[model samples]
Target: MMHNFNSDPFYLTRSHEFDWNGNESAGNGIQHVDSADITSLFSMHNGIKASNASGSLQFGGSLGQFEKWDDPIVADHTSNHNEKLVKLAQNREAARKSRMRKKAYVKELEMSQKRLLQLDQALEKARHQAAKQRHSIGRDDAFDRAHARWLGEHERLMDELRSSLLSGEGDDTTVHLLVDAAISHYGDLHGIKSKGAGSDMFHILSGTWTTPAERLLMWLGGFRSSDLLKVVEKQMQNLSLSEEQLVCIFNLQKSCQQAEDALSQGMEALQHSLTLTLSSSSLARPSSGDVVDYASHMATAMSNVHTIQSFLNQADLLRLHTLQQLQRILSPCQAARALLAINDYKARLRALSSLWLARPKE
Candidate 1:
């Protein structure tokens, strides 16, 4: 049979020379083939028979011909193949999310490490600062201790100096005499000149007195003079003694009438006394005891000057005389000059002696 069916060109077709049954004969007259028999023959036959019995024939399956198709149908097959592509894309997106999360985790760890490093640096700096502060405190404490020790030593030295000056002991009679002389001069302030540059006995002892005791004694005598003078000035001011009143009070002892005559007589008398005393001392050498007694009397006389009993202190006058007598006896020695310096004894002697020499009336 030869038939043409054309709904789709890809459907099967039958040719005239092809055989339907398993026979060598071709159909002679119009054969009445049942549809069922034809269907059965189509099922049993394969290859050439299957090709001939088909209504319209194609050489291969649609899948086999698909290779020769145009882009549209080819794209349809490619589209079907790409179904798994969506799954691949979803997997790639998941991997990307995982990688991004890993990077973010790594960054966080780096930040944490950096922060730890910063903390360590801060801790080290704080430790160094604390150490420096401790060192500074130690240095300050050391300085304070040294200063305290220095002050203690200074105070000890000053105490020794004060003690040495205060203690009156030693072997220099001439220096002692100088000291007594200084004390006498100071004691005479109220009666004599109230304020003068007034000698510092310490300077005089160091400069003038050869005797050790006398020098030390002289220093002791004047050590408190500057201080005493302050006290006296304060007392006098409190008493409201005017400057003119002070001058008048001082002049009273020198206000005797027949002034020039009295002065001449007095000077002559002082010179005579000096000559007599020197002559006697040269003949009779004095004992050390006599010299010592003379120093004591000189001290006593000086102490009595300008005291409350200045005019009527008979004991003080006797001490003055006794000191003069002893000084005369010791005049042969060089140390005798130290005694004479006391109370201006040498001058008094010279004036008395001169008076005797020039005396017209006995």
Candidate 2:
């Protein structure tokens, strides 16, 4: 009962090479192990040996040979990665469009702000201009009323003078009344002009409220004193004026002319000084806060304007005084005749003005 050993079937086991621990590295294709890792390696090696005992292992001829197998987890991970790339591209495109829309909105907002600012500036300027025009119109209307009142009173006085003259050389009793009434009316008119002088000096001085014909004869809101003297002298020419009366007339005319020359020179000097002050500097451009001293210049200009207004008031006073002196120099009959001539001149000028205003225009 003997058995043959060579005829029995046998299994070949796979083996792995181990490497001992060194300073840094284990060479390729070797299991690297330190003294601490040796215990775990023995258990792992036993598991692999037991698994090999239960199954047959197939090996290719080459050491680098690899088997190709399809796994569900690997295929799913590839599909998910492709989907992520598509999602990332879409997100980038959406972000680009959002940035473009935001930029356009910002640009439009800037343009709208600029337009709104420009509109606001134009509206403010128009409002300012309208306010100034309204003030000018108000001044003109008030002056017009005053003139109407004076004309009505003056017409009554003229009628009285005519009646007295018709009664043969006029009465000495009414002469006092005539002279007093005339001087009082003129003083009232002068006072009205002076009241408006501070705010509307240029308009009052220019006599813009008067009719065009009256404006031609106007000097500081009334007729020039020298011109009045001329009227008086002409009226007295056919009268029996004495030597003393003639001398008084000559002296009055001389003084009025001298006063006018002095005021005129003062006005010219003021205008020259203001012109030089404005023209010599480079402040023509608008001020930027404290960069330019606009307040001081404004004060200086206002002072000059006030001085000019004072001169105009003085001229008005002189004209009133001259009329009073002329009335005093003449007798009642002679003074009444002079008043009549002056009224006639004024009536002729008004008639001329009416015609001029009604003339046709293109």
Point to the candidate with the largest TM-score: 2
Writing each residue's lDDT as its tens digit, candidate 2 over 255-351 gives 9999988987998998887776566444454365644566566667778878889989998899888888888888877777777777788777766
Error of 1 at 110 (Å): 1.1
**Which window of ten consecutive residues has the lowest lDDT sum in model 1?**
189-198
lDDT of 1 by residue, 1-362 (tens): 55543332233323233344424455344434555655555654453355555533323422121122346878788887798798899999999999999999999999999987866666455445443543454233333333345435534433333333346442345444543443343244222211111322222213121122223333211222222223333444434555664564334212322332343355455446545544554235446447765555445444433231222232223333333333332322222232323323323433343333333444
Query: What's the true lDDT of residue 360 in model 2?
Result: 48
lDDT agreement with native, every candidate: 0.39, 0.73
The candidate scoring highest on lDDT is 2
Deviation in Å, model 2, residue 268 alpha carbon? 1.3
**Which residue ranges in model 2 land beyond 4 Å of their true spot?**
1-138, 280-282, 289-292, 360-362
Candidate 2: residue 66 Cα off by (Å): 99
